[model samples]
Each structure stands twice: as structure tokens, then as C-alpha cells.
Target: MTIELLAPAAAEAPTRFVERHGRRIAYRETGSGTPLILCLRFRGVLDSWDPAFLDALAAEFRVITFDYSGLGQSGGAASYRAEVMARDAIDLADALGIESFAVGGWSLGGMAAQVVTAMVPERVTHLVLIGTTPPGRVEHPSEAAFLEHALKPVNDLADEEILFFEPASASSRAAAAASNARIAARSADRSPPIAPETYLALLQDRHAEDLFPDAGGYRDFLANCGIPILVIAGDHEIVFPTPNWFALNRVWKSLHLMVLPQMGHGPQHQAPEFVADLIKSFVRTRQRADVAA
Candidate 1:
């Protein structure tokens, strides 16, 4: 499928919902090939993704993005735990009759992907974790001002940029503006913004520093998961700094890592084309390795 150069709009693909676990999970899929299920970051809805990035992936792979139950267009009770969210992802796949697929998760979504892959390693062929931190303590915490701004409503464009891009540089700020424009290109049928209380609940699990013990067991799982994995981050990431990737690499030696310069928490937005190409090439390599095995 050759997607237009422009980022895909929410209106381009109609939203579909599946009933599972007593929740109506809303999703939208584009492109064709090996199915790649994508989970959104904190407070992100199906429409929050950069249309250009989605179009790039869709051009070569079947990309699926959805809202967690009880958030956005999905109907259900709101929950915060990653375990529950992971189960929701699996149930949605089952509902769609997709037995096996690749998973790409960004930030909080990456956390959920790890849980899903850990629980059902036999079903996941590939894993992509971008701008995410490993389980356990958060080594690099965001500035309190930044965190406060993220929780409050975006009163202006600058506020939104502060959440995703670095403010110290003009070029980075410009990139953020472009990214935001692409995100809002599709105005119709947009998912409602996540509520403040709901967003707070979502952060409860993520902020639990002691959730993953330092024991070698968690590292062992990544090592023996028996799937190709890619971990991408930016050197200047404020939320999960580049060092977090190093922490994850210490345990998971097989991870394919990419660290972008002059980028923040949202490397995908800062370098969409580059990141898109990396995802495509990495997925292909993993598929070949799977066949050989």
C-alpha cells in the first residue's frame, strides 16, 4: 500500500470497536503485511500518533493503533495497571482473530508491550520499544514543572511542545510544531482528550519505582523471550533519558539500540522518516531470522 506523503488523518480510516473483557476497545488499522500492533503513550488516544509516521509504517506493514478501554472512544471502566492493559491488548487481538503479530510500543505503551511479550512469548514475533524505560526505579525523572504542565490542559502550542520536545533549541522546537500539526491534521471524529483524573490513575503504576525488582529474573525473561527486539531513544530525553536504554541493555544484550541526538522523549516525532525506515528494516530482519529458526 502506497500511502500519500502526507500523514494519514483519523478521518481517513474509520474507527472500529470490539467487545472484550466487558470493554469496547476502539482501533484503526492501515497498511498491509505482518500485523504490527502499536500501543499509545500516556494520555494518548488513537489519533495522537503522527499521521506521517503511521503512513510510513502503513505503507509497508499492517499497523494497528487503538485506545485503551475506558479512554478515548473505547467504552469501559478506567484502570491504571500495566497488567490489565496488556490483557486488554491480547483480548483485542483475539477478537480480531490475529493469533500472532509484532508489537511496537512508545513510552507507557512500551511498558505494556513488555508485559504482554513476557506473558505470551510464544505469540510475539518481534518487539519494538521506543522512548521507554525498563521496569523498576526510574533513573531519570522529568522536571517537576514539566510534569505539572503535562497533567494540566495544553493552553497553547508552546505548552504542548514542552511535553514532547526540548525548549533549549530552536530547531527542536520547530520539529515539535511540525509534529503537532501532523497530529491535528485530522480533525473529524477525534477521540476525546483523556480526563485529568484518568490520566492521574494511568501514572500510578508507572511511578511505582519498586515494581520490578533488581533480581536477574526480569533480565532473564528479556534474554530468553526468543524474539528480535529494538529499543530506540533520544539522547536528550527528559522523561526517560538515554541512560535508561543503557540500563535495559545491560540485561538484554540482543537488543538493537538507536539513540538520536538533539531529540527528547518523542524521537519518533523529531525524526519520523528515519525512525520509520528503521522500523521497516528491523521488522524485515526479524522476520528473516524467524524463518531461519
Candidate 2:
């Protein structure tokens, strides 16, 4: 099926905001049932989410994509710390009156989601970490020169290719094209660009060796957090390779790991239909278990 077939018209929902801690957190909610809050990657606006992926997930879940404070249309100060960003996510959910939900964070946001599950363990019932690295020490950091170029403001398809897909593969390049097209489908109600200072802070913060307090202890926390987790990434990810996540040793009865072939940093976009199916199946199985319990 095509992206248009899955996305339909529901993914174009208007932007909304919630006031929290003297800041306005902008967000858009799509679909219904089982709230899943998705945090964006560095320098990403809410408009950057893959439409096909969002629309597919929305069919079975209420997927929410939001901007961090001081980024996109959101108001307030911006910081590089994942813990601070995690608080922003929690606050926005509270403002929305969502008591319990799943949390999905990509890249920088994934580091924050780690704290979110630990900070308010009961609030987030499930977790999804995509193309993300653990806080503190990065065992397999992306190639420095490649990352330096990828961070530059995207001006064309070439930039998108660097940011999301592997550099030397024909299939990966095609997936990048398809992903970009889906994101461009919505021409109106787009979120504003990231502030210059905010983007800079994020860039600097992203490079920091340690963003989470006691990053060393994070692994122990997730190992026993009692919350189900799904870690999805492309095997060829240049930003944060799949092995970085595997190296975490996040062995648990409830954890699910997926490494897609010939894909890069953005597996969700590279294989939206397949990734969406994996997500839906994972969530539904958990829900059924809860019911059975």
C-alpha cells in the first residue's frame, strides 16, 4: 500500500498547545485509543514526523507529536539536558489530562524518555526508543565528519539523505525520497523553525558526554523498570548505530528489539508500514497481557 492510502486526511490535524510551567508546549494529536507521546529528534519540528508512520500508528493508537519548549511553536526556554526535556514532556501530558500513556523518543528524545520512565514510572506504561543512544557514554558514536555535515541546516534532498539514510546504498536513498515526500504532504499548519539559539544549544548539548545525572546507573534502572520497552533502529544508522542500543544489555522479559535491513537512522520512515505493524503488534500484545492479568 502507498503512503497516501495509509495516511488519508487525518494526519493533517491542526496544531494545538498546552500551557505548562509558564511555557506553551505545542502538539498535535491523531487517531484514538492508547495515547502514545512521541518526542522529536534534535532540530526537528513537529512537522518533521513521517506522515505515513504517524498515520499508520494513528489507525490503532492516539499518537501525539509535540515541540519542546523554545523550539518550534512552543514557548519558554530551551536546554540540552534530556532530563529537562523529559520534564517538559511530562508537563505537557499533565496539561492534556493524560494520566497514563506510552512514550516514544527518537535520537535526543530517546535519552529523555529513559528518564521519563524512571522519573514517573507509573505515568508511562510503555516505552519506545528509536535510533537513539543511551545517556552518558556512547559506545559507538557516529563518524564525526559525517555528523558535522549532517547537522548543518538541511537545504535540499542531499541534506535529508545525510540526516536520515545511509550514504552508500541505492535502496536507502529511495526510502529517503519516499520519507521526504510524505513529510511534505501537509502544506499548511506547519510548526515554525527551531530558534537559532535553541538549535545551537541542542547541537552543543547533543555533543556533551553526559546529559543524564548518574548516566552510569540508567542501565540498572531500565533493566528493572518493570515497563515494557521496544527498541527499533536501522542496522546502518550513522547517527546512532543499532549496536549502541544492543550494547546497553537491556535484557528483560518485556523488551522488544528490531534491526531493519538496509535502513539507516530513520527506520520508522524507511519502513513505515513494517515498523507500524511491529509497533501495533507490540502494543496490542502488551494490552492483552494487561487484560489477562
Candidate 3:
């Protein structure tokens, strides 16, 4: 059976749904190769991803993006906790009959990706973490402005610059504008923005524990998992500092880190094609080595 590939552009891909454990999970897919499931950041929906980034990645792999259960277009009980969110990704993959695939996440979604990798390391071929921190201890904390802008009911370009881009750099600011415009291009059949109340409750619950907790031996699992992991980050990430990932250098067996200069949290948005190319190289390179072994 030939599966239809959706348009690579985030604006053009049609949303699809699947039943998983009594919940209807919403997802979108493009390209055709090894399946790649991407988890979203805080308050992110399927539309939050930059179209250019998705388009570029579609050239090399089957890219899948989805909303967490009960959030965005999905239907079920919503939980922002990493474990619950991780299950959503795994369940969606299972529902789609994907046996082995790569997993990528951004910010909050990155945390969930780590959980997913830990839970089923045998099935995950590779792990890509973008603009997010690692488990256990962190070297640097997030900026105060991040939460301030993130919690707002509506975010203008200025707010987005502070939240996702490097407002101090003129080039980064330009990228922010372009990314926002691409995100806005999907005007029809768009997923609704996450409600403020839901996000606010998430924040309240998060305060009770560490952002990236070492629960269930996460750090040890990551350190020994042997999965080819790629971490992409900006030099000056305000939300999750790049230094946090650096703090764990050489700790994981097969971890590769790429820090983009003069960028912020959303490096993929700032350099969509570049990031996609990097990902393609990373995944293919590791897969070749695995086959040779």
C-alpha cells in the first residue's frame, strides 16, 4: 500500500486524526523515508512549527508533527507533564504502525522526547533535541523575560523576539519576523492557540518540581542508552541556556552537540534549511555506522 505524503509546507499539510487509547490524536506528515516524529514546545500546536523548516526536512525523511492529547485539535484529557506527553508521541506512532523511527522535540517537547527515548530505547533509532535542556542538573537558568512573554495571552513580534529569538542581534530579529510570517501563512484549518488557563496551570504544576527532573533514572538512561543523539541549540538561548547542554559534554555515549552562533531558542526558525541539512547529515551518518557495525 502506498501512503500519500502531505505537502511539505506546514501551511499546506492537511491535519489527520487517529484513535489511541480512546483519544483522538491530531497529526500531520510529509516526505517519505524513516519516520521522524517531532514533539512541540510549550503552548505549541501543529501550526507553531515554521513552514520552511518542515519543508526542508521533508526532503530527506518522513516528518510527522502532532498535537498533545486534549490540546490543539486533539481530543482527550490534557497533561503537560513530560511522561504524559511522551506517551502521546509513542501512542501516536504505535497507532500509525511505526515500529522504529527517530524522535525530535523542541523545548518542552524536547523533555518529552527524552522521556520517550528512555521508555523505549529499542524502538527509537535516533534522538534530536532542539532548544531544550538536559535531565538532572542544569548549569544556567532561564531568563525572567521568557516566562513573562510566554504566559501572555497574545504575543506580538516584539514579544516573540524576546521569547524565541535574540532581540539583541539585528539578524536574529529579521529571522524572527520571517518565521512569524511563515507561521501566519497557515490561516485556514489552523489549530487553535493553547488557552492561557491551561498553560498557566501547567506553570503552576511545574513549579512544584524541577523542569527536567531526573525521575526514573533519566540521566543514567541517557548516559548509557547508546542511541545516536543530536542536540541543536543557539549560543544564547534565553529559555533553556546552551550552557546546560554543554555542562553534560562527554557524559553521554553518542551525543553530538551543535551550537549556532548569535541565535536564540529557535535556531531552526532562524536557519530552517541549515538546521534541516544538519539533521539529515546527522541521522544518515549514524545510520550508516550502525549498518556497518
In terms of TM-score, the best-performing candidate is 3
Give per-residue CA lDDT, model 3, range 1-293, as digits (tens).
99974555667889999998999999999888889999999999999999899889999889999999989999998888889999999999999999999999999999999999999888999999999988877768889999888889999999989888889999999999999999998878889998999988876776644678787788877876778889999988999999887757777767899999989989999999999999999999885123211
Clashing pairs in 1: 7-52
- The per-model lDDT (C-alpha) reads 0.77, 0.78, 0.89
Clashes of each: 1, 0, 0
Model 1 bad stretches (over 4 Å):
1-11, 205-207, 211-218, 287-293
TM-score of predicted model 2? Answer: 0.89
Where model 3 places Cα greater than 4 Å from the true spot, the runs are: 1-8, 288-293
Residue 234 Cα positional deviation in candidate 3, in Å, after optimal superposition: 0.5
Model 2, C-alpha of 120: deviation from truth (Å): 0.9
Estimate, for each residue in 91-173, the C-alpha lDDT of model 1 and write its tens digit. 88899999998888887788778777887778888899888767666566655656767778543568766667777778889
Work out the TM-score per prediction: 0.89, 0.89, 0.95
